[model samples]
Target: MPTKTTVPEDHRDDARPQFVLEALREHRHFVMCAHEKPDGDVLGSGFALGLALKAMGKTVHYFLDDEVPRNLRFLPDADKTQRTFEGIDPSALYVFMDMSDRARADDALAAVPRAQIINIDHHLGNKRFGRWNYVLEAEAATGILVLNLIGGLRQTVTEDIATCLLTAIISDTGCFLYSNATPSTLRVAATLQDLGADKDVITEQLYQTRSFSGQKILGRVLDDFVLTDDGICYSTVSQKLLESFGASHEDLEDVVGALRAVDHCEVAALLKESPDGSYRLSLRSRGRVNVMEAARALGGGGHFRAAGATLAGPLADALDRMLTAVRAEMEAERARG
Candidate 1:
C-alpha cells in the first residue's frame, strides 16, 4: 500500500473559499470532462458535477472522449454528453473530474491550453494538471469531491445527482469492498441513499447485469487463466476469441473484475487485444502491490490497485514482459513483508 499522509480534512464548509464560490457563481458557461476510457467513477463524478452546476443556473456541457458505457446510460442527462471537439468554445471554465493528466483528457486536452482548468480527482498519482487543482488522495472517489463541491451551493441534491454520485462512489470503491473505503465513504454513501439513490438498482445494473456474449467471453478468459510465482494470475483475450463469442469491447468490460475474484491471487492481469493491434492491459492488486507504478513504467497511469496501459506489440510478447515485471515487483513486496 502507498504511504498515507495527513492533509486538511475535507469538510463541506471548509472545502471552498468565498472567492472561489463567487467565481463559480459568476461563470456562465462550464465544460466538464473526464479521463479517457472513463470508468463508472469518472462518468458519475463528471455528470454529477455538471448537473449540480446546471442546477446553480450555470450553462454546463459535459465532454468525454469515449462513449458512455451502456450500463451508465441511466445517469440523468447523459444524452447531453459531447463526444466531439469541433467548435468547442475554449472560453468556458473547464472542470476535469477523475483525470490525473492532460494526456488522459483525450480530445478535451486541446481546450485546456485556453481554458481555466479546475481538476478534481482521487488518484494519488494525479499530476495536479490543472490551473486550480482540488486533489484529495485519501478520498474514496471523485464523486465524494463532487458532493463536497455541491454542498457549497446550498441546494438540495436531487435523485438524479444522488444516483450518479452513488454509482461513482460504489464503482471506485469496488462497491465499498476495496481497502480504500474509509468511514467517510460510508457516510457519503448513506447521505446519497437518503437523497434517493437506490443502491440495489445501481448494483443490479452495474454489477449483476451482463450480456450473454459478455458471459461467454468471461468464461473463455477464466478458462485460460494462468497463475505464476507469488500468486500472480493472468489471462489473455484475443481478437479471435472475441469474434468467436460474438463479443465486442463492451462485452469484455467486466473481465478484469472477474479475474480479481480468484482465490489466492495476489495480483490479476487481463490483457485484451485491441482492434488497432495494441494490447490493452488492466492490472488489479490485492492490497499488496502498487499497480500504478508498474503501469507508469509501461507509459500509463491510474490508482494504486487498479491501473492500466496499452502496449504496441504481439499479445504474447506484451503479456510475457508485463508478467515478468509483475513477478519482480511481487518478489520485492514479499521480501519487504
Candidate 2:
C-alpha cells in the first residue's frame, strides 16, 4: 500500500489552511471518548490526547462507557477517566478515538449531539461520524494519529503522554508483531521510549498480569473450543458458567484470543452472555478472514481482524446465525482460491 498524506480528504477543499491544530485551537471544553470495552489503543490515545490538551491549558474530559481493564491501570491518568456521562454538559466538544461508529460510544454518543465531533481512528470500517474527521487507515494505532495531531508540540509529549501512546501502540500492534506495524510505528515506539515509556513496565503490567479468575475463564473456554470447516474455531460461555466461576465479563477478556490461537484455525468466535440477557459476540480472524464485515452484518463494527456485535436472543440462536455467516464467507474465499 502506498503512503498517503496525513491530511484528511475533507480538509483538502480549504486552500488557505487545514490541520487538526487549527481545529483544536478553536474548540474549548473538549470531551475525549473511546469505544466500548476499550483496548489499549482506545484508552491510550484518548488519554494522550486529553493530557496534551490539558498541557495547552484547555479544559478536557475523557469518557469511556465501560470500566478500564485492571491490567491497564498502570497507564498515567487512567484513574482520571470518567466511565459515566451523568453530569457532562453536552455543549463540550466531543472527540471520538479508536471507535468506528457512533453506536460504539453507546449512551455517551447522545450526550453531546450538537457538539463538534472529531473522529480519529485507524479502523477501515470507520463511519467518519465527526464534524472534522481524521481517519488514518494505514496507521497501526490511533495513538499514532494523536501523536501526529500534537506535532510541533513535541514539548507536550510528557511522561504521561508518552506512556499512554506507548500503551496504545503496543496493544494495537500486538506488541510490534502485527502486520499493520510499519517502520514508522517502530520509530514512534522508540520516540515514546526516549520520552520515558518503560517497555518492561508496560509489558509486565499488560501481558503478564492476569487475574486468577480471568485465567480460569480462559481455560474453561478453551476446553470447549470447537473447530468448524476444519479452519474456524469457536467457544461459548453461558451465564451459568460465568456464575459458577464467579467471573464477570472482564474475566473473559482473554478467551476469544485463546480460541483464535488453536492450530489450523483461520477464525475464532467467542459468544458471551451480556448482563441484559443478550449475547455479546466477539470474532477474531487470521490473515484469510474479514471478520469486520461479518460483525457489521450483525449490527456491530470493528477492525478487519477483530470485530464484535451484540445479539438479542438465546446464545445458541446467536451462535448459529454467526456461524452461518462465517461459513458462507469462508466458502466464498475458498471458491476464489
Candidate 3:
C-alpha cells in the first residue's frame, strides 16, 4: 500500500503549500492529470497550474482521460492537452489535481511511471492517495488551493490564470449558488475579477452558450421528469434519445442541474446510458439530503450536495436498485426523527 499523507482543512496553512511548491521546484518536468470527463473545475484548475509551471520555465504536459466537453473548448490553451503520453519521463512529476481517486485520472494513469505524486483536491471523501495530500474540505474547488501555491511560489496570477481559476470556482459551486459557497469563495471571485478574469464572458461561455443539441436533450429529460411523493425526482436519457436528438454525451451534463431546479425536489437524479450499456448516474441534493452518501454506496463519490456513480445497466433495473438504496436512506433519516 502507498503510504497516505493527509492535510486537514485547519493545517492547510504553510506546510502543505510548501510541499507542493517544493515538489514542483525539485522536478524538471510534470505530467499533469485531471479526472475523466474533465469538467471545468478539473480542466480549468489543471490548465491554470500548467500555465504557472510553464511560466516558471518548467516543462509541463497536460493529459486527460476524456476529451474536453464541446462547451468548455474555449478554455485557456485547452488545445495543447494530449490524450496520450508522447514521452514518459520516469522522473517527471505526476500531479493529480481536483479529483479524489487515481483511477479517476484515466486508464493511462496505471501505466504512467512517476517518482512522486502530489494529490490536491477539495473533496472530504478523498483517500489521501498521494505522497502529499493538501486537501481542504472547506475549499469550494481545488483551484483555490492552486492559487495558494501560485502565491507561495511568488508567481503572478495573470489574467488568463485568473480566468481559469474563476471558472473552476464557479463551475464547482454552481456559480456560487451551492451551499459550499462561502464568503471566502465570493472574496476569491472578487479578487479574480479585479485581476481581470472577465466574469461576463466566462459565464456566457459556460452557461449561455448551450448548443441546440444540448437544448433538445434537456427538453427530453424535462418532459419525462418524474418526481416521487418522497421528493425524489428521477429520470433517464437513453442512447436512443441522444441518437434522435443528434446529441452527444456531453450535452446531458447539465440536465441533472435542471432536474434539481424542479420545485419541491429534495433529491434529483439523471442517469444516461453509456456506450457499454452501464448507466452514468448523477445525484443532486437540496442540502436536506446527503447525495454523496448514496453515490458512495453505489461505488461512486462526490460532494455532499452533488454526487455520481456508474452502474451495470439495463437502465431501469439499475435505477430500481439505486433508488431502493436512496429511498431506504431517506426512510432511515425520517425514522431517526
Q: How do the predictions measure up, each by TM-score?
A: 0.90, 0.90, 0.93
RMSD of each: 5.6, 4.2, 4.2
Ranking by TM-score: 3, 2, 1
For candidate 2, list the clashing residue pairs, or say none: none
Per residue, candidate 3 scores C-alpha lDDT tens digits across 9-79 of 33334335666666776678987788878888888888889899999998898887677887677788788
| Per-residue error (Å), model 1, residue 165 | 0.6
Tens-digit lDDT track of model 2 for 101-170: 7777757567565337777888886776676777788889989988987763444788888899999999
- What is the C-alpha local distance difference test score of candidate 3? 0.82
Candidate number with the higher TM-score (2 or 3) = 3
Error of 3 at 81 (Å): 0.5
Clashes of each: 0, 0, 0
lDDT of 2: 0.79
Clashing residue pairs, backbone N/CA/C < 3 A, model 3: none
If the candidates were sorted by their lDDT against the true structure, best first, what order would they fall in? Answer: 3, 2, 1
- Alpha carbon lDDT of residue 145, candidate 2? 88
